[model samples]
Target: MNIVNEIISSLKKIQESNEITVPSIKNKLTFSQIHCIAAIEYIEDANITKLSQELGMTTGAITKMCKKLLNEGYVWKYQKEGNNKEMYYNLTELGLGVCKIHKKVHEKSYNKKKAIISQYNNEEKVTILRFLNDMNSIIEDTFSEVVENYTGSDD
Candidate 1:
């Protein structure tokens, strides 16, 4: 198989893996909501704008998601002393617990992926990263082209 095809196949396999979930969030939160919790816990004085930017999502979506999170007791909104316009959220005790579970899962995933990279020598590692970067650039260019040339499709 071509190297690019092999890499794409590997990525498809990764996406199909069943071990990509957090038990703490099982049936309680969507993966995006759980990820939002993780981002909120990481960013100091977390606000919708900051969380949305960090997670590559829209503030509108974050606002809606946060509503569920707030209602479900995962987070609570508060003001910074005198500034009510600037809303921030802090994780509730339950939110913190879930965040911890998410963190542990993230660490395990990171370590496993790191172990895979560790098998390669330094030169091979640099070449691998460069190739991936090039692939990403190509995809980005292709996406831009698709958007720029978009027209109504007929099926």
Candidate 2:
């Protein structure tokens, strides 16, 4: 297969791999939802805007996901004193547990990748990083254009 096809296939596999159930929650979560939960844990007093920025998602998408999360008992929303208009989120106990699980999952994945990459010398590693960075830049530019030109299409 060509390099582009290989990369696309790898991405599809990664997406499928990321669909996992948090043992504590016992419910399957989408990768994006898990990241949203992680973002909430990472950001202090997370709000819709902050989460959108952190996740590189639109506020509308974030809002919809957050509603599901709130309904699932993972997060709760609150308004700051004298700031009724703006709301913030806090991870529930369940959300914190999910965060811990997510961290462990990531640490394991990182360790596995590190083990694979450790065989590469410094120069090879630098080359790998450079290649990945270039790919990311290209993807980012393409994503920006797609978003800019996007019209309503049923997902």
Candidate 3:
């Protein structure tokens, strides 16, 4: 178990944990779609620009996802009074249901991780956090080019 291998293993577990199935959804949602719906619910006055920022996606990509969500009855588009140019998005009942299920899954994951981390002393926790933050910066810098050119087709 080298550090790289350990980090890769942890990422795999995180991915597996995040894979969710919503019973109420007639059409199976992709991970991106599920997160987009959740983001809509989480972000106040959700719009393509805001969603793009929140999801680390391009506005163009967010627009496409929004259209699909709208067609599937998961979300709806609207405009604030006196402002028709900047469209906003919100969850329909169906989207809300999916978001709720997504939230429960996240809560369960959070609690499990919290319990594990709680065993660590404050100094150990700080050290772990600092290490993770550094690793995040390094990974981001290393992958910046790949991420910038990504088409997001895998999602």
RMSD to true structure for each model, in Å: 4.1, 3.5, 4.8
Per-residue lDDT of 9-82 in model 3, one digit per residue for the tens? 99668646644567867777888999999999989999998999999999999999999999999999999999
The runs of at least 3 residues in candidate 1 whose Cα sits more than 4 Å from the true structure, single-residue gaps closed, are 1-6, 15-20, 26-32, 142-155
Q: Ranking under TM-score, best-scoring first?
A: 2, 3, 1
lDDT of 2 at 121: 99
Q: Point out the worst 10-residue segment of candidate 3 by lDDT.
A: 12-21
lDDT of every predicted structure (CA atoms): 0.84, 0.89, 0.89
Candidate 2 lDDT over 1-155, as tens digits, reads 99989988986676468678667586788889989999999899899999999898899999999999999999999999999899899899999888899899899999999999999999999998998888789889988788777753434
Best by TM-score: 2
Each model's total of backbone clashes: 0, 0, 0
Q: After superposition, how far is residue 50 of candidate 3 from its true place, in Å?
A: 3.0
Would you give me the overall lDDT of model 3? Answer: 0.89
Put the candidates in lDDT order, highest first. Answer: 2, 3, 1
Q: Which ten contiguous residues of candidate 2 have the minimum total lDDT?
A: 146-155
TM-score of 3: 0.71
